[model samples]
Target: MARYPTITEIAQKLGISHSTVSRALNDHPRISSETKQRVQDLAQQLGYQVNSSAHAFNKGESKTIGVIVPDLSIHFFAKVVRGIQTVLDQHGYCTLLFDTSEKMESEANAVSKCIAHRVDGVLAAISMETTSFEHFLKLSKHEVPLVFYDRVANFIPVPKVISNDYQAAFDATMHLINSGCTQIAHITASINLNNSNNRLYGYLDALKSAGMEIDEELIHYYHLQPDSIDTFIENLLTSHPHLDGIFVFNDYAANYTVNVLQKLGKRVPNDVSVMGFSDEPVATHMTPRLSTMKQAGDKMGHLAAQKILAIIQKQEPMEDEKIVINPELILRESTR
Candidate 1:
């Protein structure tokens, strides 16, 4: 492969020392303006690009941020990534992405690889099964700032950019209740996740406030694969025939559940109402447009990127300033 023009090569071509070339490229005061301009113009002509890898070898960081997400197939993560890239690009920083495939081991290994690459910092959304945080300490030990978004490991003392989950869930459940849904059921993800736990509490709290009984049978929690989701939802509806409303973990699952309910002869918003979290594209595109809690994925992504930059630039650890973007409920055809 052809190599990019180097500083030494530029200096040799211009009959100057490499140090002079470096000074000129950096716009150092010692280098005359004429000399700097001449060298820069020549460098541009040669298609010269700064070697971030070489810089990291000599001065620690590669000026690149590592972003880890559970999976890229999900559109929400892709939207977040677009937002991160927008902010990172403005600051002349590059992003390195790693998809953990929602596995705990894969997440740990991804962090290790990022550390090995000498990234300036890390922004992550932890895996579903991740519990042990010892793997993330490598960045802290090396003084590379780490920031989390969406699904976070709160035990780690890092600032996070997250949606206002509790309030969103509360409002969503209350919406269902106000819509006259008396038998509401919740399909949850792993209870270990803070957001999942908060959503559960929110659902129960709404029930308490509505003068309703918090039935344990009304809530189902699991970490099933995509293929099994339909079966699970089918079983859920079959067992709980009285459930008039369902609040799902995400929009994809909610969509699947709606399809399953339709197969079982249950009409959405008539026989049953459905609400989902993270209002992705499917919400608007689905047969009965979904009612959902709109998490600002793009905003969360931008904030996570900015958080890492602030922490690394300041040479400080995570602080109390956890930025929380409030989620909005989008009422649609899925709910009456």
Candidate 2:
């Protein structure tokens, strides 16, 4: 492995004072631009990793941000991270990733670590189990700008970048209704999540508008798993007994629904109709291609980066906007 050079070693090699090399490494305004460029070029050649811990302690700028996500294996969160990386990489910022795996304690610990590291900002997709906002509030006390993307805490007053969940669900439900699906059923996440509530509201709104009675029993809410969900699906079809259309709140859940439907000898769109949110890559390739609400995950992630960066820079007073990106409803074999 090639040895990395420290500032002191670089200064000795270039026959310059350590202070001069330090100033040049930081591109201090006092240093001549030509000298700064020369130092940077040589540092790049020598593969110098600026000791961010030491530099941030001295200058108070970490030049990095922390991202806390509920789960990285999900396509939606992964795409959100990709979007965040695109923006951060362009702005010369690095990211520290923390996966909470939907655990409340893990999310809390991740927030503290981000604060201890003195990240310039934080972009978080809060875990589903997070009910208290105190963990996030700690970041504010330390003056760390925070932005929420996708799943978020409703009580927190921060710039949020999210898809129009309510509207997206409404649109998906409306699409199913238009496709002659009258007896519709909804499979949603636990109601504690703001996103889940929004989706549920949308589904209800569409059903009400169509003059269909909201059958409380037709709505299924549970933690996601394979075997557990299979039981839910069986109960859903057996108890209600009249479900022609089904709206799953997320793509992953919808995929599982299709799997269960197949095992139960139900043909998608022919025997029943289905729709899901967040047009994950697999939605298109399902046996009966899934109709889904397409959220702009990349757009939300990039916008979160921009807003957090702006907050860190203390840019001119602008309205704290709740950016709700509209979703697209894609029709496919599942909802034909």
Candidate 3:
């Protein structure tokens, strides 16, 4: 194995005292310019390198950031990861990423891993099943900063970045109404998730504002799973013949609705217009394409990264700070 030169070896090679070499390497104000230059020159000549671990140990920082999200395959999370890496990598910090698979247990374990790794900071998006946030307090008690983004925990008073879901959903509902859709139906999920709950409210408020009576049958709220979702879609479609518009919780469900409609001999837009949230990649691939709300995942991810970085550097206060991004509606073939 090749031997690497150390500070002591550089001192010996330069015929200087170890303390002088150390002071020169650290660029102490008391050290003369000539001595510092000589120490650097000798270090370069002897292939001597400073120990990063020792340097960080003296500064009481790990220089590593931990990131936790519910799922990575959901293109939205993937975009956010890119934004995080862009900023953290540029600052010479390492990123430790964890996926929760949308399970609260997995998210809790990820938090423990971050604490064990002694990360300087953390950026997280809580899982849909996450209601108890006691695990997050561990990072706070340890003095490691944590920032939440997108799917956040409102009970925790920490820095966060999220989009305006209520307004976005309202806009989507208004668009469906303007497109000549009456007797609309909304498909939603777990009320624990702010995004899901706000979306449901947005739809109801839009209908109420338009003098449409609130019908309990028009709203579908349940724990969504792929295998069982198809069966539910069929029942909703068959039972609600008057529903001319269907606003789905996400892009995946919207696509499923389109497929089920086609199989039931229903024409999209002509028979039933559809609106989906998040504008996922597959939205444009369907026969009539899909119209959706653009959630600006990249922007959300970038802001989260910036917030955590600010806390880590003490450039901004870490308490109760939040940044909200607005979402836009995208007109496409699925909606008239």
Candidate 4:
């Protein structure tokens, strides 16, 4: 195995004390300019890299942030991670990314790893199966600052960066109503999730505001099952043949819903209009492209990163706070 060149090796080669070499490498004010140049030149020639762990140990900080996401495959989450990296990189901090794959057990293990790594801070989005928040609360005991984005625990007294899911869903449903869509259906995620629950409430409220009948059968609580979507749509069309509009919580599911609708001999925006959320890449890739609400994933990520950094730096206190990003409506061929 190739051994990494260290400052001791550099000092031995330059015939100087290791302390002088270290001071020169760090550009200490007491170090002379000539010594600094020679040390830097020799270090570069020898391919010597700074030991970040030792540097962090001396400073009593990790200089690293842990980011935990339920699913990295989702485009929105990937964009959020990119946004976080952009901010963290600017501040000379590195990221440790963890994907929980929507499993509570994986999320718990990721939290343990973050604590073991002694990260300066953490940013997380709870998984679908995360009903208990004990794992997240453990971070507080270790004095590790934590911030949440998107899927968050409402009871946790920490900063949260989130989209205005309720307003977005309400507006989407109201748009369908304005476009002459009566008897609209809604597809949402698990009830345990705060965002999905808010969206479901928004959909219901829109129908009530428009004086349309609120049919329980029209609302489907999707649980990450593709075949369930088909069953719901098939049963829905059979029970309510006049269904005209469908609002889904996500673009990927909306795309699947559209495919199912087509398979059932329904024409999008003609026989049935569809609206989706998050404006993911799948929205445009699907035939007859989807009309959706655009959640600012990158902006949310930036806010979460900033909040955690502030907390870590003691510029702000870690308390119960919410920073909300309002979503924009993106109209396309999927809806009238």
Expressed as tens digits, the lDDT of each residue in 5-33 for candidate 3 is: 88888778878889999999999999999
The Cα local distance difference test for each model comes to: 0.88, 0.86, 0.85, 0.94
Per-residue CA lDDT of model 2 for 281-317, tens digit only, reads: 8898788889999988788888988988888888823
State the weakest 10-residue window (summed lDDT) of model 2. 312-321
* Highest lDDT model number: 4
Which candidate leads the pack in TM-score?
A: 4
What TM-score number comes out for model 1?
0.89
**TM-scores for all predictions:** 0.89, 0.88, 0.86, 0.95
Superposed on all Cα atoms, the candidates' RMSDs to the truth, in angstroms, are 2.7, 3.5, 3.5, 1.8
lDDT of 3 at 232: 62
> Per-residue lDDT tens digits of candidate 4, residues 215-321?
89999988888789999999999999999999998999999999999999999989999999999999999999999999998898889989999999999999999
lDDT of 1 by residue, 156-257 (tens): 888888888888999999999999999898988887688888899999999999999988877777674655666666766778778899998889889988
Off by over 4 Å in 3: 1-54
Give, for candidate 1, the lowest lDDT window spanning 10 residues: 224-233
Please list the residue runs of candidate 4 whose C-alpha ends up more than 4 Å from where it truly belongs after superposition: 13-16, 27-41
Candidate ranking (TM-score, best to worst):
4, 1, 2, 3
lDDT of 4 at 42: 95
